[model samples]
Target chain A: MSVRVVVRTFSELCITVGAVIVLFVVYVLFWTGVKADTAMDDQIAQLEEQWAKGSASAGPGDPGSARGPGAAAPKAVAYEDGRPFAVMYIPRLGFTWNKPVLEGTRTKTLKKGLGHYASTARLGEPGNFAVAGHRRTYGDPFKDFPRLRPGDPVVLTDGTSWFTYRIDTRPYRTLPDDTAVVDPVPEKSGYTREGRYLTLTTCDPEWGHSHRLIVWAHLDETQPVEAGKPKALRR
Target chain B: MYGFIWRHLPGNTWIKALISLVLVLATVYVLFQYVFPWAEPLLPFNDVTVDNQ
Candidate 1:
């Protein structure tokens, strides 16, 4: 090819590459958020529909009876991986702020909603119920994670009851490998013994994951769904 | 690169332009639906948990 034609082809190739990169950015920043929001909505709808139908296998059984004196703790639901079984609302994050809590922390599961660390205690149990969420993408579910403060309430519903957890520590920054942050009695979490706890983790620095931000909370109360909304969630 | 395709698209000017638009959109759709999602795990931005070792 002539020198001019060669240069034209090279320039066109550069323009195409630049366009692809920009479009990839658009896909990551906007398109993924769109798809994730829809996925989260569908997850919530799935849980809601299941709740509305009152399926026989609903595992959190008879919250009212479970809480009575001499009654056993409610049975933990056997959640399938990547499936959402609860909806969480962080009042400190916002009154309208809510997200589905899926069963595992896999990328595909996190894309739909917050991922519950499978090893941790299930909701309202006697150990830490840890969850992870993206801070900048996949709808930025925990983008305001740093805004959490001591005494903030993180309420969750399993359609059978409301489990309200009270934050006991501010957002604590730690290395990503500090898996102890999700341990049954997490280090630096100020608990002397095993107890019902909640740990919310997200990427540190808002848009990067070089580190993690953790907020530890203790289960403060449990109210049956037949009762009205929890005090923290009362409008 | 576009010039080569524009010259060969069998149609009047407007029709060729429309066809080019359709082709570009189809390319984008493919990238979003399959290519970008397939490539997403290789990028580091999506990791939000300590479990990803």
Candidate 2:
């Protein structure tokens, strides 16, 4: 090729490569969110169907009456990886700001919704029940996580009962290597004794995961599905 | 590069546009299906994790 033609070809190649890179960024930021939203909607629909059937068979017995304060605590059901076991609702985020809580904290699980740390306490139990979610992309379920404030209510339901947790502290920035944020007592929360705690974890700074944003809450109340939604959830 | 492709292709402007579209899509497909997957683990995206300590 002549010198002029060679220069023209190099410019064309550079433009094509630049366009490809732009397309890739669009795919990662936009297409992934679309796919995640579809997957989460399907998962939520399936869980709702299962809960409807469960309640139908359980009859009119009040769920709260079965597990009152003095009653023996029900056995915690084992959850399979990537399987959703509960739905989390943060009224402060928005009335529609709810996501399915899956069993494990793997990438695949977080794409569907929130992922519960396997080592943490189970929902509505004594220790710290911790969950992790993506702050950006993959539906960005915790996109508004920074908006949470002390006294904000984070509610979760396992189809039969509703667990309402009150945020006691603001978002605390921590390094990715700090696992003590989810400890049974969570010394980071200044607790020395065991108590019912809920921990929400997500990537800090919106688009990056260099650090983690931790929010600690205490279980404030528990009610049955038959008793209607909790007062915190009331509009 | 595009000039050479245009001269070598045996079609009108419409057909050339279609061919160019196909080539771009094929490039993307190869990058995502093979190249990107190979490079993913090398990136720091998945390095975000809390230590057991």
- Candidate achieving the largest DockQ: 1
Residue range B12-46, candidate 2, lDDT tens digits: 98998899899878988887666654554343443
lDDT, candidate 1, at B47: 73
Q: Candidate 1 lDDT, tens digit per residue, A64-144?
A: 364631122345558889899999999878899999999999988899999999988888888889999989878988988
Worst 10 residues of 2 chain A by lDDT: A68-77
Off by over 4 Å in 1: A55-75
lDDT of each residue in A205-224, candidate 2, tens digit only: 77666788889999888877
Cand. 2 Cα-lDDT: 0.80
lDDT of each: 0.86, 0.80
Give the TM-scores of the predictions, in the order they appear.
0.93, 0.87
Give the RMSD in angstroms, all C-alphas superposed, for model 1.
2.4
- C-alpha lDDT of residue B51 in model 2: 50
User: Residue A98, candidate 2: how far off, in angstroms?
Assistant: 0.8
